[model samples]
Target: MLETGATGPSAIVLNGGSSSGKSSLALALQSELPGSWLRLGIDDFIDALPPRLVGAGGFEVEADGAVTIGPAFTALEQQWQAGVGAMARHGAHLIIEDNFVSGVAAQKRWRKALEGVTTAWIGVRCTPVVAAEREARRGDRIAGMAARQALIVHEGIEYDFTVDTTNADPTTLARSIAHRLAR
Candidate 1:
C-alpha cells in the first residue's frame, strides 16, 4: 500500500504519445498492484463531457496532416490535468494516463499540481511505426496522430522509469513497475 501522508494518496503518472499502450499498462498495473488503484485518463475526461461539448474544442487533423486543438478543448484538458492531481491529494491511489504534448501549458500545470503528492512520472514509449500501426488497428484515433505526437510528447521531461511497449507485453511491464513500486 502507498504511504498516505498529509497530502493524501500516491500517484503514478504515465506519459506517452497516442497508441503507446498507456491504458493497457494501467490495467496490467492495477491487476499486479497490491492495493486498490484508480485508473484515470484523457479518455475518461472526454467521456464525461456531454456529446455536444466532446469535440467542440478538440483536435482537428487537416487534409495536409496538420493537427490542431482549439482553445476550448485546451481549457478543458487543463482542468482534467489538474483534477488528476486533486484526486490523488484527496486520497485516491491513481494511475494517470496522458499523452502529454510538449510546449503545451497543461504539462507545466500538471507538474505544479502534483508537487506535494508522492508521485512517480513514468514514460511509455513505442516506435512511431508501431504506434501508427496500433492506432490504425484501434481505429478510434485520428489518422497520423501517433506520428505527430511521437515527435513532441516526452520533450523536456524526465521519468522515474520508462517502458517501451513495442517489444514487451503489458503484463511483463506491469510486473516490473509493480516490483519497483513495492520497493
Candidate 2:
C-alpha cells in the first residue's frame, strides 16, 4: 500500500496485453482512488506529439505484429516523468496506462520516476482469441491488438499485480483496485 501523507497519492502503472482493459482500468483508478489521481496515457502523449519526432516510418513491426514505439517513447517518457514530478509536488496520485515494452530497464525507470510514492504495476492478461474478439468490439484499429500483445509479452512479467480482465467489468475491476488501494 502507498503511504497517504501530505506528499501525494499512491502511484500505479496499468499495463497489459491486447484488450486487457488497461485504459479502462486507468480511467477507473482516477475515480476509484481517493482524492484526485492524474492519469498519463502513453497513447495520448504520442498522439499529441509533434509530427517531426514521430517521423514518417515508425518502429519495425515485430513478428508478433506489435507496433513498437519509435523515438517517441523517449519523448513520452520525459513528459511522463515531468508530469509525475509536477503531480507529486501538488500531492496527487499518478496512474500511468501505456504499453512500455522491454524489461528490467522499465522497472528501474518507474522506480526512479515515482520515488517517494507507493508504486505498483497492474498487468492484465487475455488470450489472443479473447484479444481479437475484444478488439473487434472495442473498435480498435486493425493492428492494435497484435501490437499490444507483443508489447505485453515483452513487458507484463515486470508487473506486481496481474489480473485477468476477460471476465470482469470496468466497475468490478475498479472496485477491486479501490479495495487494494484502500489497503
Instruction: Tell me which residue pairs clash in candidate 1.
Output: none
In the range 1-183, model 2's lDDT, one tens digit per residue, is 345444334677776655667778778767777778778776676677667655444434454445555656565766677767567656676777755565556656666777776676777666667677777787744555544673455452565556776777777788887776565
Using TM-score as the measure, the top candidate is: 1
C-alpha-based local distance difference test score of model 2: 0.65
lDDT of each: 0.78, 0.65
Model 2 compared with the native: what TM-score? 0.77
**Model 2 spans > 4 angstroms off:** 1-9, 55-64, 147-156
Q: Enumerate residue pairs that collide in model 2.
A: 66-147
Per model, state how many residue pairs clash: 0, 1
Poorest 10 consecutive residues by lDDT, candidate 2? 55-64
Worst 10 residues of 1 by lDDT: 1-10
